[model samples]
Target: MDRHDQVLEVWREFIATGKISNEKILSPAIMNSWKRSRECGVDPYQKKVPVILKEHKLKNLLERNKDLIEICRPFIDNLYSFFRGTGFVAALADVDGYVIDVTGDKEVLEMTSRGSFVTGALWSEDVAGTNMIPIVLRENKPCQLRSTEHYCWSQHRMSGVGAPISNPAGQMLGVLVIFGPYEKANPHTLGMVVAATHAINNYFHVRRMLTESQISNKFQKTVIESIPEALIAVSNEGYIALANENARKRLSLPENITGKQIRDVIEPGNGNFLSIISSKNNIMDMEVQIIQDRKPKHYLLTCNPILDAEDNPTGKIIILIEIVRARTLVNRMIGAQAKFSFKDVAGNHPRALETISLAKRAARTLSNVLLLGESGTGKNIFAQAIHNESNRAKGPFVSINCAAIPRELIASELFGYSEGAFTGSKRGGNQGKFELSDGGTLCLDEIGEMPLDLQTTLLSVIEDKSIVRIGGREVVPVDVRIIATTNKNLKEEVKKGNFREDLYYRLNVFTIEMVPLREMKSDIALLARYFADKMSARFGDELIRIDDDVISILTNHSWPGNVRELQNVIERSISVSLTNVIAVDDLPPEIRKKPAAIERDVSLKAMERQLLLELMQSKLSKTEIARKLNVTRCTLYRKLKVYGIPYQ
Candidate 1:
C-alpha cells in the first residue's frame, strides 16, 4: 500500500492494541509524538481540534504578540505567494500553540475551519495530536507532518510544515506554519518558514540595538551638561561637535554652534588649533582668551584628545574655567585671602577710631587708598581690615611688599612678565598681583619705596584700570582696589624726587593715618588684653593677666615700632611668663625703665649712665642713640668716657 495507507494502518493498530506493532513504518520523531499524544488521552478518532480559545482570550493573545505578528506579516504574505493557487493555509501561532493569525485560499480555509484549524485554535500535540505546529514548538526546530503522520483522525487528510520564530539568543517565541492538503506535503516548506524566521530575527535585533544606542547617548549628554565648567567636543577636522550650556555662555557662542569652525569660536593664547590637533597631546590649564565686545575674556583651558582603537586622534574634549574663578581658587591655595575685618582693628582712642571710620568709608568706594604710618603702626592691618570689609570681601587679597622685593624684580612682581620676557621668565607667562587680585584688593606695602620707573607703570594701571605684562602687548583688564601703605611721608619723598608725585596724589584720594602706639597710649591697656586673649586661645591656655605695672611701663615707652612692637611683646611675655600674670620684667629690655620714685631719688649722673646702657643694648645706632638722649655727639662721647662705656 501507499505510505499514507500504511501510516493509517499503524495508527489503527496502536489505538486498538495500545502498541506499535509495525514501528519500522514510522519515523522516530513521529512515533515518539504518537506515544506522547496517546499518553495525554487524546482521542485518535476525534474529528476536530478540541482546544479552540474563546474570542476575548484570543484577542488578548494577539495583542501581546503584536510585535511578532507585525514583523512577520510581510514575510508570511511573501511565503504564501509561492503556493497561492495551491491548497495551502499560512498561519502564525504563539509559543502556547494558539493560532494568532492566518491566510489561505478560500476553499482550503473553509475545509481547515471545519477541522478547527483556523485562527485562535490550539494545535499542540496533546489536543490536536502529532501536528507540525506542536512538534516544531516543542522541538524548537522545523518539522513537516503529512497525512496519517498526524495522530488524530481529523488531521489525517491534512499536512503542515512549521518552524520556530526565535530571538537572537535562539529562545523560541512562536512558530510559523503552512498547512496544505495531504497531496501537497513537501520537506521544502520547512525551509521557506525557516528563512522568513531569520529575516524577522535580524530586524528585531537591529531595532533593539538602535533603542539602546539612543538611551546611552542621552545619558552622556546629561552628564556633560551637568558639569559646572564649560565643556566642548570638537572633531579632529576643527568642527565643533558638541557644547554644553556653560561652554556656549562662557565663549559667547551662538546656541547652535555645532558644525562651526573651532578657530572661528575661540582664540588660543599659545598656538593654533591645527597644531594642537596634529600634536594629539593633552593640554592642562593653558591660558586662552575669547573676545567679547572687542575685549578679550581670559580662561584656563584643558584639552584631552579622543582616540580610536588604534590610538589615533578622532576628536577632542575641552573644559574651560573662567580666569577670575581660577585665580580665586589659586588665591585660596596660596593663602592670599583676607583674614581680618574692621572689628579686628583693636583701639578705642578717638584718633584710632576716626582713622578706622574713614577706612570703612573708603572700603565702600572704588577709589585708591593710602595708609600713612610709622613702621609696625598696623598699616598692613588696616589694609587687611579694609579688604575684608569691602564689597570684594569674598575675593582675593593679594599683597606685595614694594620695599621687600628687589628693585630689579619689583616690576615683574607687580605687573607680571610674559613667557621668555626675561632670561629666566617662566613658561606660559605669569599672572601678576594685579591679575591675581582681580575683583579684589591689592595692598602695595611701602609704596614710597617702589622704584621711580615702576611707579609710572603703577600710575597708568591705576588710572586705566588695566595693565600690560612686561614684554607683552595685550592690555589685560583688572578691577583691583589699591591700598598703598608706607611709613615714609610720601609728600616728603615726592618733594625729594624719590617718589612719583602724580602716583602719590592718585593714591592719596582717601588717606588714613595709622595712629602709633605712643600717640594712642590710652588704648595700650585694652590692646594688651586683646592680644593676651588672642594668644591664650591660640596656645590653648588661659588668658594671661597684664599687671598694672606692666601696662604702665608699656605706656611710658616710645614704641618706634608702634602697635606691632606691642603685639610682639605681649606674645613674648605670654611665651616666657612662668605665671599667668605678666610683670614689668616681661617687657623687652629696651622698653623697661625705672619707676617715678626711682627716677626722683637717682643721681642725674647715675641716671645718664643707666640710659646709655639701655640704648647700647638696643638696636639703635650711635646717631639714633645721641638723638634719643638729646645730646650732641661731642658731649655724648664725653659722657660715654666718664661712664667707662666702650664705643664702636
Candidate 2:
C-alpha cells in the first residue's frame, strides 16, 4: 500500500480493536517517534518510505549516515503518529521537485510516488529542483514550502516543511520533511519538527557513550594479555570467566579455562586456599609449595575483589606470581645448641651403654677425642650428648666436614685466613673453625679424608695449642676440645700411606664407636616411632606407624648403609605411603631381597668367633688372621678367649 493507504489500514486495525477506551488519539507531528523502533531492523527513508511522514530524519543523517533508510524508519513512525486522520511523511526535492519518505492516505501516497514526487526526485536547485527539505538542509535551518511555491508550474500541487537536526557537537544530521494535502501554514507544526530534532540529538549523545565503553573493554583485554603476571578473573560464583595466556600457561590448562570451576585448575589444596581468599582472610608470606610431575614449584597467590561503580564487590581477581625459591631448609639437628644429654641417648646393649658412659667421662677433659661410625649411626647425636655434658657446654659447637671441603682449601678452612687470600673470598679476614671454636668444641666430620698437608698443619696446631692464619705468619693461641669423626679405619689409611700414623696417635685421646643400625635391630621399632612422631610434627601431617610386617622386614635387611639409609627409606615410605600404617610393601626393593628376620640375628661377637675359627682352620699365622681382623695377635687371642674359641 502507498503511504495514504497504509495510514488508513493501521487506522482500520486500531479502530477494529474498538476497546479504544484509551486517551483521544494523538495528532500527527514529529515527536511521536514511531519510526525509532525500526532503525535496528529495516530501512524506509531513501529506500522504504517517505520523509514528511517521519521525525528525527536529520538526526539519522549525521549519526546513522551509513544506513539512512533504516535510521529514518523510527523517526517516520513518530511523525505518522502525531495526527490521527490520514497523513503521510514526504521528503521533498528542491522547492519545484520530488518527495522522499511519504506515508498515509493510500490513493494520495501512490499518486505521489507515480508523480516523481519523492526520494530519487530532485529536491534542490541542482536537480528536479526547488524543494524546502534539500534547500533548508543546504542552508542548515528549518523552512516551509506550499504548493504555490513549487517553481515548476506542473508540480505546484504539494506542500511540506523540513528541518535539519544538529548533534551535541553541533553538526547537521539530515533534513526532515513532513507533508500532507496542501494546508494553510501552521507555524506551530514547524516548531514541532525543530523540537523533534533536539530529541534526536540527545539520542546520538547516549549512543556515543555506549560505543566508547565497548572500546574501553577492548583496551582492558589487551592490557591483561600483555602484562607478565598470570591474571585469573572469576565470577562471584567462583567460576572462571577470563584467564589470560600467562595464566593458561602457568596453570597448564589445555582448553580455554573459562567457565571451569576454580577447584579444577589449581592444586587440590589451593581450592581450599582460594575459599579462604574469597573469605577475605590470608596467611601472608607463608610459603605455599606445589609439586607437579615430581618437580617442586612455588607460587604466591594474592586475591582481591573486583568492584563495581557502586563500590561493592562483584567478583574476585586472583593474581599468581611464581616464587623463585623458598629458602632451602638448613640442617637442623640437636648439635646446633647441644640440647642432647646422655639421658636422651638410648642404648640398652651393654657395650653400647659402656661406650656412652665412657664418652661422658671423656667429655670432662681437654682431650682430642675421635668417634668412629657409619653415617647416620647417631655419631652426631653422640657428639652432641658429649658436648652438652662437657664443661665447655656454654660455648658454641662448631662443626666442619673435612672431606666435604675441597682438597685444595681444607687447610685454610680449618685455620684462619687473611684478607685477599683468594678471589671470591670474604672482603675481610675470616676466623677459621679453630678460632671460632675457642673455649668450645670443634667437630671435624670425615676427618680421615683430610689432605696430608692439612693433617700436618692440624697435628702442629694440636701439639702446640696454636694455629697460624693461611696467609699470615703470626700463630694464635687457642683453647678448644676437638671431636673428630669418620667412617674409615685410620689403620687402613695409614697402611695405604694416605694418613699420618704419628698424627693419629697424637689425637687418639679417647675413642667412641657407634653400632650400625642393622646390628642394633632391637632398637629399630623404638627409633621408627620416635622419627614418625617427630616428622609428623615437623610436616604438620598425621603421625604414622610401621606395620608388624614392615618392622619384620626392617629387621631382616643388611642395612650396609646404616642409619642414614634407614632414614632415607623411612622418608621415602612416608612420601609414597598413603595410609597411616606403613606395610612391608613400602620398604625399598633391596630390603625385599634380604634373608628372613631370624636368619640375620647372629651376635657381633659370635660372628667374629666363627670368622676367626674359619681363618684358623686355614692354618693362617696369628699375625695374618689378626691383620685380616684389623687387630694385633694379642688382641685376637684375647677376643678368642672372650668368645671361648679354643685355638689348639
Q: What is the C-alpha local distance difference test score of candidate 2?
A: 0.64
Query: What is the Å distance of residue 590 in model 1 from its true position?
Result: 3.9
TM-score for candidate 2: 0.40
Q: What TM-scores do the predictions have? A: 0.56, 0.40
Q: For model 1, name the residue pairs that clash.
A: none
State each model's CA lDDT, in order. 0.83, 0.64
How many angstroms is residue 578 displaced in model 2 relative to the true structure, after the best TM-score fit? Answer: 2.1
Q: List, residue by residue over 252-336, the lDDT tens digit for candidate 1.
A: 7788889998777664542443464345667877776656555566777788988899988888988888888888888999999
RMSD of 1: 18.4
Q: How many clashes in candidate 2?
A: 53
Worst 10 residues of 1 by lDDT: 269-278
Position 430, candidate 2: lDDT: 56
lDDT of 2 by residue, 1-648 (tens): 544333434434433452223223423221121222122222212322232323455434323344433555676667667743545454423222334445555676676666555454444444333445545765677776665343333344556777776655777656667765564445566777776665666677777788788989999999999977678888788889898898878766656678888777765545545655567542333323454444455555667788899988778887766642111111123233566788867656666777888898888877878898887787777887788899888776878988788888777768967656777666435557787677678888888989887788888888888998877665677787889898999889999999999888876778888888777788777766666666656655557778787777787777887766777788766554434556665566677543465344554335656787798789788888877866545556655665577866
